[model samples]
Target: MKLARFTEQGRTRIGKIEGDRIVDLSAITGDNHSMRRLLNHYRDWLPALQAATGPMFALSGVTLEAPIADPQKFLGIGMNYRQHAEEARQAGIPIPESQLWFNKQVSCITGPFAGVVKPAVSDKVDYEIELGVVIGQRCRHVKAADAADVIAGYLIVNDVSARDWLQKSPTFTLGKSFDTHGPIGPWLTTADEIADPQDLQMSLYVNGERRQHWRTSDMIHTLYQQIEYLSTVMTLEPGDILATGTPSGIGAPTGRFLQVGDVMRLEIDGLGFIENPVIADCAQEVMP
Candidate 1:
């Protein structure tokens, strides 16, 4: 089932996307729980909940929000694609053999179609298209072979970066965690729906120009390995998010960067597209 969150009458609710409408789970079960809460107990409630139904609202009319609200951990992998790593290397930056990971604080979460605020303090805003993995089950020290079992679903993610700030720190948090920078979710397509995570296609466009075009099959460390590698260091819990790295063709590689009013469109085969328009942030407005 496609799980999502939407706002109706100023209230947010977890829903199941049916066609172009959202079936309100709260109204069906009469419980005020978010998607994360429902996902925790999904095994018991899902079967019955799938059978029950309530008012279905037209999806076009309801405001779509990030499908998962406030994920426990929002992790991102950098340079996971060999080609992407090579691009960085060509830019005089060394690429790491192992996965280089970073955290995107939950505070940066934004809707798929939300406007991206280009911070005034930095002039190097950029866009990255990535596949987002949503954990369904908790697993620690998970084996690469068994990693797929712990996955719940997938979503399209745009990992917007402030290139100037990113280079200043070894860690990417400061550049990647800007508010409204992490635009994820049109909806989470359940694992069962996607036959193979590595078989999907990814495409990214900046202002209608195709920038990043690659296949997940090209990932240096596939999803399974990424999960296993991460689990070895920390517990992977339900509602945790992993943004598999982007492919080559980022602005940094081409000496191109985002400007105010730029539109970025990111899409994966099963996971729907997320389009965000760049806007000036609080600081940008004060420029002389």
Candidate 2:
């Protein structure tokens, strides 16, 4: 089932998507005020939510939002895709010895259809379309074999990056965590909704020109392996997200970085599609 979080009037609410309408689930558990809170009761409410029905509202005209606005952690893997890693190597980045991880600040999170502000400080903005794995329960030291049990579902993630800052700074977090950089969701798709997360086709297009196209089968390390690796370091809490890296065809390698008005469209099979417009920084005021 496709569960979406959106705002109507002035309040944020959760809903179940069916056909071209949204079945309101705001009153579902009576305890989940936000998607972050809903994850705490995801298992218990799954059955009820799937079987529920309410006032059907048109899917359009609602203010859609990131599935979970306030997750405890927003981590991402780097160069996990075979072709992506190859591109990195060709671009002078060393081959990874293990799953490389980076932090994408929660503040960067934005709705899937929102505009991504091209920071005034950088001219080399880039896009990385990745499958976002949303954790369902808190766990540590989980084995890859048991990782599926802890997963809630999947979503799309546009891991936007600022190349100059990324390359100049010693760490990847700052460049990757710019506000509005992490565009996620249309909704969260439960794991049961997906038969196998490892064989899906994913693609990205810029202004209608297809740039990246690959399958989850092309990932060097499986999502379960990434789960096991991440869980061992820190507890994987409900609503925690993992952007499992991106495929090749990034703009920086071709010297074709984004300009102020470019649009990026990303999609993953069984998940959803996201289209984000790029705007100049001056068009978006920086928060003090």
TM-score of each: 0.95, 0.96
What's model 1's lDDT at 278? 93
Please identify model 2 stretches exceeding 4 Å from their true place.
Answer: 29-32, 283-288
Give the winner by TM-score: 2
Instruction: Please tell me which predicted candidate would have the highest lDDT against the true structure.
Output: 2
Query: What does candidate 1 score on TM?
Result: 0.95
lDDT of each: 0.87, 0.89
**Cα RMSDs, all models:** 2.6, 1.5
Candidate 1 lDDT, 1-288, residue by residue in tens: 888888888877878888878888875445554666766787888787788576789988888999887789999999888898988898888998678999998889999889999888888988888999999987899999999999989999898899998888778899889889899999888899999899899999988999999999989889999999999999988889899999999999777999998899888997778899998878634546
Q: Model 2 scores what on Cα lDDT?
A: 0.89
Off by over 4 Å in 1: 28-33, 284-288
- The C-alpha local distance difference test score for the whole of candidate 1 amounts to 0.87
